[model samples]
Target: MPHDHEHPHSLLPPEPALRVKALETILTQKRLVDPAALDEIIDIYETKIGPRNGAHVVAKAWMDPDFKAALLADATAVVSELGYYGRQGEHMVAVENTDDVHNMVVCTLCSCYPWPLLGIPPTWYKSDAYRARSVREPRKVLADFGVELPVDTAVRVWDSTAEVRYLVIPQRPAGTDGMDEAALMALITRDSMIGTGLAIAP
Candidate 1:
């Protein structure tokens, strides 16, 4: 039931649901929606349309001590320095993930994501299923996403409200002591900022 896309609580209207269901049924019958299309869409959106601003911020923070300090102190000003400021990001905080704790974000009500950096919210992220389940069973929800935290690690759930949005600055992975900015950006996934995945080791 958790995976069901239809429920009275869904924000989608009945007409849209019917059309989507019909399309899904047709797609299943014809096998028309290519599996690779999903990845292709993601690639286009992330690389072409989605702002690389967040990755830029992360790289600068890693390389410049003063900028990093300013970012930790006030993310908005630091972001504006790169001409990446936006309505949602006007007041942002870069929470650093550590060994003792992990962070995950949820809106609890609507899907309030860092669109200037991450682009459109993923379908799963906007679903009522995720919104309800995240608060009720955060660990389980995270585990379902393949993010397994240690038993002793505390999970901090930051509910994005109407006023503020949050982004996580995942700790730089090891074995990349001398990696440059471009290479480092390749390792920063949207999930890392959302706190659902750790940055991969370069």
Candidate 2:
């Protein structure tokens, strides 16, 4: 006779968030990590350093033609001068979205994201489903993200690697000519820099 019951662990959903929580618990129990310190760090990245940094870059590009040109030509060097160069962001390439084309970035092999600009990569970006589908059917992926481009607009996919990463510069929205850099930054979202969404219209 065999037992009909599944293992208790099997009852848990195969979600990465659950696994991360479990690991954190274990580390905390072992006194290897301080929850308070971890929370503070996460807060800093989420509120101060994450998407805001990328938005600053994007807004500067939108307001300064020379900066935009330099960013598109040599992203690593240009961003470095702005104090954005580090670790996973050691090398970057900025791809501008024009009327005829759009650009998106993904790391199929793993989540090789630009941490300095984007902070932590979103869970979906590291998922196997996104990693596979994004390359095979990018237009569909964009549509799923609620971004509908003109039929004539071309979608370009960039694969981030250990040595190089990409930042997508979404087109500047209309009615933004009078806005300053800080105001422009307010319109830029993390997904916009990832090319899954557009800048918010004023």
Candidate 3:
């Protein structure tokens, strides 16, 4: 008998939020995880701790040129000055996006990320597809993520290793010179630090 019934499995999301839900479901079904605990961790990453810390870092860097210079020179120390360091983010690197260069990050081996700053890494980031293709076809992958760079803009992909992870300092959007730190923080997002999206405009 040709069975048309689809096997029961957690339906994953096409976007970030629901993807976490799906990952949790899969782990729970395997009896390898606790849903409540997972939910709590996810909440902390999404709201209280993760992305907010990265936003502060990016906002401060944008506002102060000297700090920006220091950040680029020694990312680990500069990020530490902001007090963002933890399990998956012990070593940090900041890559700036300018008119001539677009920076992206990926862990080819696994889902190594700077969670202390950016929060729970996105589902797409941890996926095998992204790990494999981000290095080989970065331009195509960036296009899929909706970031289209200019033809002459050089794309640099930073491979996240066990010793170090990267944070992409997305180019500050135009017309935001007058915005304060709080306002600038609001413009930054999880994906912007991950190099898959841009900061919001004022």
Best by TM-score: 2
- State residue 161's C-alpha deviation in candidate 1, in Å: 1.6
Q: What tens-digit string does per-residue lDDT give for candidate 3 at 72-110?
A: 888888888778877787878899999898888899987
- Candidate 3's C-alpha lDDT? 0.86
lDDT of 1 by residue, 131-183 (tens): 88887788899888888888898888898877677778877888977889998
Q: Per-residue lDDT of 2-109 in model 2, one digit per residue for the tens?
A: 345976555445787896787788889999999999999889777766878899999999999999999999999988988888878988999999999999999999
Instruction: Report how far off residue 48 is in candidate 1 (Å).
Output: 5.9
Against the true structure, candidate 1 reaches a TM-score of: 0.74
Return the top candidate by lDDT. Answer: 2
Ranking by lDDT: 2, 3, 1
Candidates, ranked, TM-score:
2, 3, 1
- The per-prediction CA RMSD against the true structure, in angstroms, equals 8.6, 4.7, 6.6
User: Which pairs in model 3 have colliding backbones?
Assistant: none
Clashes of each: 0, 0, 0
> Which is better, 1 or 2, measured by lDDT?
2
**For each candidate, what is the lDDT?**
0.78, 0.89, 0.86
- Residue clash pairs of candidate 1: none
